[model samples]
Target: MLKTLTKTLLCVSLLATFPAMAAPDGDMAPSDKQLAELYWQGQESLKKSDWSGALERFRRLETSLRRTEPASADAAIYWQAYALLQAKRSTEAKATLEKLKRDYPDSRWSKEAESLMRQTQGRPNVASESSGNDDDLAEIAITGLMQAPPERALPILRKVLQGSHSIEVKKRALFVLSQLDEDAALAELGNVATTSNDAELRAEAIRMLGISGEDTAIERLRTIYAASKSSEEKRGIIQAWMIADKPDLVMQAARSETDEVLRKAAIQALGAMDASKELRQLFDSEKSLENRKSILQALGVAGDTRSLVGIAASNESEDIRIEAIEALGIADDDDSGENLVRIYQAASSPKIREAALQGMLISDDSDSMLKLYKQASSKEEKQALLRMLTLTGSDATLDLIEAELDKAGKQP
Candidate 1:
């Protein structure tokens, strides 16, 4: 039975790849042998700590691959950022790292970029000599301090946190201190979160406090959020609450916050928590069309597809209904595809019909769509259905259309 099941699964997997065979040639990703060779040469330069040489190679590779090999370009950008860090070009390195994380978030290279970001952001180069041993020693010292008992480590870490060490070293100390259970450690982190001059260091402190998840740490975050005049600081505090899974605090902020952008951030955080009930309640009570749209988006984020369908069905404003219809697609509401088709049939507005058709395509209701195409009375409606099928890249639907066209050709 197991062998039969395995064979069945293998056949199914191969069958799934058939759609790609019918897809347009534009779907193919171009490959370059020269780019691969140059990438390895850059890696060799990095291995030798030849920062300038590596930076030059990676920059050229990134320019070459940006359009043809986006994934490779993302990697090249990450390596370029690392090379910049190693070359003591701090500002450009930080910018490049941020770009990598923003543009290709799902790329494996983003993980390495995040690590380099933490090390390079606020910290100046503290290695007096361009020696690998010095770099090794700094890391080892931080690790050794963290491994020691709080009684032994606290004094050293306290000095490091307060001292004019490089930003990277201070960040390491803050992280280790956050992990410690000592009251003094929490106090130091709280102090840094509240008082640090460097915005990046303060954000890092807020992050560590949130990870600690101590009641006192949370209170500090709240206090900082309430007291800080800077919008950036408040945004950081909200993000820290998100990381700590404090949805209640986020919801509270969403309700009370005056800044439109920050309020949206809180709502997004609630959405990330799967707070469907809260989002749905907000959707019902919201008066502003903009806020209602946000609630629909949040419900989609929380995977509350049922609520989205109801909103799409009943919302009076065609524009709002269109937004909700798209949200249904985001929630992957396969069952709602027919509802979208119904909306399309009823909608007099071109944009609303377009939105409904787009939703159906996203839900992969190609079988229903093919039936709809057959039932269409007018040439315009039939043309619309054919365009939608092409947009969806439905191989079976395409085959059906091709057969119909061939039959027409033979008849003429």
Candidate 2:
């Protein structure tokens, strides 16, 4: 009974894949917006199971696209036929399918139409008929094994992995193997992660191991990370560690990993985990300018405005200071605007001043900005403040502009 159910599930999966097939080759023309809206209405109607409404919309779409986009018209016709089948009008559905096949023999919808034709004729779907093939049978067998006791299922799943089955079949077997709670299942998954000849399968097993959240699985992941030479594999391990909420593991990679790209990936993961203190420490001790910049960016992602404020005010390189200021803008913490105002006041370089002004603008600190404009000693500074204030379009700023205009007129 479970075997039959598994075969049925396999057939359903194949049928589901039909609608997900790629659309026709060309991009839709801009003028097709109205037609696109009509198509969306049809899809929405189909989703609601309003068969008559769906048929009406698609019928209209078919007539409209019949001339310039016969391929799209064929798609409309296919959906119209689907609506007919759902409404239990099989005779009309068959007739519509015949029209699709006869008019656009090369349509992308032809394969799906043939399947619908079998449905109308009360014959089994092609998916069910193809279930006797070796790959399909293997997948079906593995899916069925998912319902059995773990002790009985694990050995069969293991054989499926070791045998000459297709990658898809083995992936299904691995998936079932991962679902089991036994020690044997973890061992098998670890074996696949470490020894699989296929890189894709190995990555899949690694991801599954992390998701298992078992102590042994976490240890295995660390062991894999230590020995793996592939940057891609190491990056995947870092991501898995992030998923498992192991920030210390991620920070370890961020600090020690020699590959710059992988190290940045780990830093980014730490930011995502909101490891502000660790990132701050890394920033202070790190000697490489590029990695320090990366750590600052990570701090921004962690929303650690205090660290960013310190970096912005530090004697770091102008480039690093500007990066921190910009990250502060992105962080947009409550005190960011106040800190930016202070930075602008203290900065000696025109470039640093400009970056600080931009940060103020981003933080929407228009009040502090207007105050700076009032205190400006140079025409360049006032003009720069005017441009950023114009972007804000605040009434107070506009009034200030008008007042400045009057003062300039009197001076002339």
Q: Report, for every candidate in turn, its global Cα lDDT versus the true structure.
A: 0.72, 0.77
| Per-residue lDDT of candidate 2, residues 139-226 (tens digit) | 8888898789999999889888898877778878876776677878988999999999888788767766765667788899999999
After aligning candidate 1 to the native by TM-score, how far in Å is the CA of 331 from where it should be? 1.1
Alpha carbon deviation, residue 353, candidate 2 (Å): 2.4
**Residue 96 lDDT in candidate 1:** 93
lDDT for model 1 comes to 0.72
Query: Which residue pairs show collisions in model 2?
Result: none
Please give each candidate's TM-score: 0.63, 0.55
Candidate number with greatest lDDT:
2
lDDT of 2: 0.77
Q: How many residue-pair clashes does candidate 2 contain?
A: 0
